[model samples]
Target: MNKKPNILLIYTGGTIGMIRDFKTGALKAFDFKNLLEKIPELQLLDCNIDTVSFNEPIDSSNMKPEYWVQMAEIIEDNYTLFDGFVILHGSDTMSYSASALSFMLENLAKPVIFTGSQLPIGDLRTDAKENLITSIQIASKQENHKPLIKEVCLYFEYKLYRGNRTTKINAEHFQAFASLNYPDLAESGVHLKINKEYLFRSSLNKNLIVRKNLDSNIAIIKIFPGISPQVFQSIFNIKNLKAVIIETYGAGNCTTEAWFINLITQTIKKGIHIINITQCSGGSVIMGHYETSRELIKAGVISGKDITTEAAIAKTMYLLGQNISGKSFKTIYETSLRGEIT
Candidate 1:
């Protein structure tokens, strides 16, 4: 007989982890120790469950690399004991955190599902119960006596998305996230239907590697009309800046003005990597497709392809931390490392 998979629920703080006092009507963090009592339906699941939480719950806006490291450490410490992990994080920065973890937890061969709700768990019409419950169920799913999902993912509303490919698109709706360039890995309705072909299956031969060294010496230059040379130049002057992500216009096109081109050229020559990514929410950056962007190609700017800004930042920081440099950095940055791009 197959043993029930052990699932670990890591509450890192978010609306989903809160409950209203009912009498005082004040919101407070929900105690995961009594998770079963609060959400008794969890007992119906086939898996054994456990819970862990941050020492002090933080608002997702305050999320940092250190918190990412803490999350990775929790997963590492319990990697052998649990078959899967579910992280409850604030929706505002959930994509960024999920993207960072996708790169940090190398050779991941089990599901790390991130999820949260638009409303508190104690609200009259809260979405937390459904999201949290389904996430745990997804984490416990198995095939051939092995985990069915083997990569980082985010579940919200009824859609499951590759973590690195997702972006929070709505602020006041139940469907708070989307994967513009990738398909949903699974969906919940009458039945839980998983798109098996879209699942990421890493090779199981290698050991799970938790990379803690993440460099944050990076900046973003979101190109806009009326942006001045002085402003752009000042970003390059930030101390110890190692890389910059330029959110370029459609297809990675930018100003053809000589001043703009020269500044980009100079930045690249200084060994500061510049990545050209599309500002459009749903398309890939086709560098050199237009005359305006040709100079960027000539200046050796890295292409972010279809990666989201959140993933771009995470990927750049992860690579920079690994001490990858020169042409090697550009090459790897342009390539998809965690199913983040096409």
Candidate 2:
């Protein structure tokens, strides 16, 4: 007889956890301890569900590294007890948290699915029920007695995306995120379909390792026409800055102006690693592909190559926390580990 999967639902706060009061029309947190009463559909799944909520639920805008650490700790503490985890988080910072967690949890052998909805769970036409239900189902999915997904992923609307590869592109629509460079791991429709070819394969021999320390001394500089030297110099002057992400033009092209080139070169020389990513939504950064980008290559800027800004920031923090030397930081940034970059 097959044992039903045990899935843990971590409610970290968001629209999906909200229930509207009919009398006041104000939304408030719904206790997940009684989740089955709120969403009876959960009873249909052949899985044992458990719930954990933050002591104090926070708005997504208030999300920080400390919250991420807490989430990781929860997963690590319950790593062996649960077959999978489904995180209910706000859409605003969901991508960032998901991306950071992807790097923090190493050698993951079970699914960690993040999801949220656009409306309160109590609303008659709310999307919360479906999003939450599907997320839990995906987390519990198994084949041949082995978990199908073994990585951190975001299941929003109807698509499953590599957590680090996703970016929140919509504020009001049901589809809140898009993985521009990578393909979807699964798509829900009349039937729940898994794109097995796109799913990450994990090594059964390696145990999951959680990284708790994250260096937050990083900044992003989006290059723009008519950007002044003073503005550029100010960002480079941030005291004790560890890394900077330069959002460049097409294919990582930036101003070939002497002042801009010299500024970046000087920053690189100062041991501040600069990563050059394309500002375009869906394209890889090809350093030296054009005259405009030639000087960036000469200046020793690392190509971000289709990585979203959210993932780039998380990767920088993760690598910086490792205290890697300046000589190897560029190499690590350019390499793809969690499919964050092409």
* Highest TM-score model number: 1
Clashing pairs in 2: none
lDDT of the candidates, in the order given: 0.95, 0.91
- Please provide, for model 1 over 194-223, each residue's C-alpha lDDT reduced to its tens digit, 9 standing for 90 to 100: 999999878778999999999999999888
How do all models score by TM-score? 0.99, 0.99
Tell me how many residue pairs clash in candidate 2.
Answer: 0
Residue 123 deviation, candidate 2, in Å? 0.9
Deviation from truth (RMSD, Å), model 2: 0.8
| Candidate 2 structure quality by residue, lDDT tens digits, 229-331 | 9987898899999889999998888888899899999999999999999899888899988999999888888889999988898999999998989878888
